[model samples]
Target: MAQKYKYARPGVETTPWNSLDVRVTDPFGNRITFTQRLPE
Candidate 1:
């Protein structure tokens, strides 16, 4: 299935392995992808 959402207004913090999961439907239903780099 194509991803319908990406990114969220999380709490006060976020990590690469953590997800806020707040979803809103995209009218266009376009696929989106995001990458979070690990801390160096």
Candidate 2:
């Protein structure tokens, strides 16, 4: 019996991260926010 294996795929659609936002609270009752923006 022969074994089948998958190789690296070609012509994969690539997309960029547009933006992101995150918020967090610390133990000292503090608020934190992180924002990121990417170019098209």
| TM-score of each prediction | 0.26, 0.44
Q: Rate the local accuracy (lDDT) of all candidates.
A: 0.42, 0.51
Candidate 1: global Cα-lDDT?
Answer: 0.42
| Residue 9 local lDDT, model 2 | 20
Error of 2 at 35 (Å): 0.4
Which ranges in model 1 have alpha carbons more than 4 Å from their true place? Answer: 1-25
Clashing pairs in 1: none
